[model samples]
Target: MEKGIIFDIRHFSTHDGPGIRTTVFFKGCPLRCIWCHNPESQKLEPEAINRTKKLDGQEFEVKEILGRYISTDEVIKEIETQVSIFDESNGGVTFSGGEPLMQPRFLLELLKRCREHDIHTAVDTCGFAAPELFRSILPYTNLFLYDLKIIKSDKHKYYTAQPNEIILNNLSMLNQLGASVMVRVPLIPGITDDEENLLAIKEIVKGNNSIKRLDLLPYHHMAKDKYRRLNLPFELEDLEAYKNERLKEIELMFSDLEMPISIGG
Candidate 1:
């Protein structure tokens, strides 16, 4: 039995994929995005996160475990409980991260098991993995929630610790292979939401017909407290979430692409 570190499992999630979904948030990531909301998920190993609460003007702290090492069978058992709901709603399981590809073998096992169980599956990826590793799981993945951040190489490396070369290459290959991919662009203010980045993304989508949809995920400061819980700095603390008007404006940029465009998730 292969065990992997998972930070969280979100059930009844509509934003992760079509219909309702159970999103398994795998721990660890290769790239360090500045505006990352789940700071606790970034680490590969199990760690403790501090949680503080104020009750009647008194502060109390509790330690919460961020990661849990569970086998593939263990996960499948939990997912099995929702099999009926998944069938009724056209929804299934979604492997999200901290880059699920970071735990390739473990993820592959789960995908295989999901296929055996006759469940529709989805993967929310950062698109920063080897082409072979990515393609290996394609047959099992029904939909891909692919993340496309900064298009420019320098800017990509500046925001995320890793370069975008591999990410772009893998995406192109996925397109060439005829995969169902929905490009998810994180609209981080001052970082990923700039005009140059949006235009570049437009060109990328314009060239790739494999892209089924383009979802503009507006930036939010809701994860600021998560950073505080992990004792990590929230760089985007001063930045405000994107207004609906601005997100619609960004959506207009892709109107010429002739693909389904949505603003959230």
Candidate 2:
């Protein structure tokens, strides 16, 4: 039996992809983005998201949680229970992560099984995984909520502790594949809200017809407290959600780009 380390699983989420979704948040990530909301999912540092997790119909956690390895059959069975809901809502399952691609094989099999069950699938990724890994699984993905942290190389590294190489490459591949994609950029007040980053993102999206929508997720400090809970230092404590007007300005700027401007999920 294969069991992948998991931290959280959210159900009936209408935001990630189309319709209602069951988001499977896998544990582990490659980049250390300061503004990461799911700090618990940011590391392979799996133990338990909650020593006493409440398991109900809507939210299900495996009874015997272990290491990052999980059986593919078991996961598909859990997903199958939601098929009726998925069918009604036209929403499927989303394999989110600590960077879902971090466990490439696990994610691939997960996605493959979802497809076999005739479910719509989406991958909420930081867009930082290896190119080959991305190519192999994307064929099974119905939609992608690809995150755009920073466009400039140096700025991106400073913010996420990683380069934009693989990230951008994966985005490009998504464009090339004609895959349904929505570009999600965190509306950080100082770091990501700059003219350069916004403009660069604009250029990239404008150049690709594959992208037709942009979702701006405003920054929040709600996740800061998690760092304290987990004994991890909060790196983005200084940042707050961008002002309403500033966020509107961003939306207005992209409004001219001829895309649907979804403010939030």
Candidate 3:
């Protein structure tokens, strides 16, 4: 049986996809982006972390396990429970991660099962997988929430610990395959929101019909506490989210693109 390590299964999520979605967060990733929001999703195995809890005005630490392995059948059963919700809202299941591609077989199995139940399937990915892996899951995936950050190779490697070549190539391949993709960019204050990087991204999506939308997600400090609990460093600890004025300016940079542009997904 194919089982994938899963950390979370978020139901009634409007941010992950169209309408209300049930997002299955797979555990594991290949890249190490310094500004990752879900730091807990990076590890492939189940692990314990210290979480601070408060009760009756007193604070204490609590130990919590973060990930688990579950079979496709088990996951499908959960998705089945949301069928009525999916049918009414045109929403369905989203396989998110660390990076869903890290557990290709497990993700593929879940996607196949979702298709069998007539559930709309989307994969939220970092595009750091082999070409063949994308091809294998293409048929099963109805939409892709693709993340692209820092186009320059050196900067990309420095921040994400991975090259942008594979990411860019796979995106191009998807465009050629006519896959429905919504490119999502993390607008880190100084790292990814620069004029050069935004212009470069604009060029890539300018004429691509496969890319249906572009979501500019501003950086936030919501995961600071999570990092503290996990004993992980928060590199952008002092960084702030983009102001409305600046976001408007950035949005104008891609106004000429054929796809829909929004501030958040």
Alpha carbon lDDT of each predicted model: 0.89, 0.80, 0.90
lDDT of 1 by residue, 1-265 (tens): 7899998888898999888889999999998999887777788999876777669999778888889999999899999989888988999999998999999999999999999999999999999998999889999999889999999999899999989999999999998998999999998888888898899998898898789899988887678876765566787778887788887788888888888888886
| Ordering by TM-score | 3, 1, 2
lDDT of 3 at 54: 73
* Candidate 3: tens digits of C-alpha lDDT, residues 1-265: 5988999998999988787899999999998998899988988999898877779999788888999989998899898999999999999999998999999999998898888889999999999999999999999999999998988999999999998999999999999999999999999888999999999998888767789899999886676767876677898788876688999999999898877899977
Number of the top TM-score candidate? 3
Model 3 earns a TM-score of 0.97
Model 1, global lDDT: 0.89
For model 1, name the residue pairs that clash: none
Off by over 4 Å in 2: 47-69
lDDT of 2 by residue, 130-217 (tens): 7888789878988888898888888899888898988888889888888888889888778888888889998998998778688988
lDDT-wise, the better of 1 and 2 is 1
Write the candidate numbers in order of decreasing lDDT: 3, 1, 2
Backbone clashes under 3 angstroms, per model: 0, 9, 0
RMSD of 2: 4.9
lDDT minimum window of 10 residues, candidate 1: 225-234
Worst 10 residues of 3 by lDDT: 223-232
Query: Model 3: clashing residue pairs?
Result: none
Where is model 1 more than 4 Å wrong at Cα? Answer: none
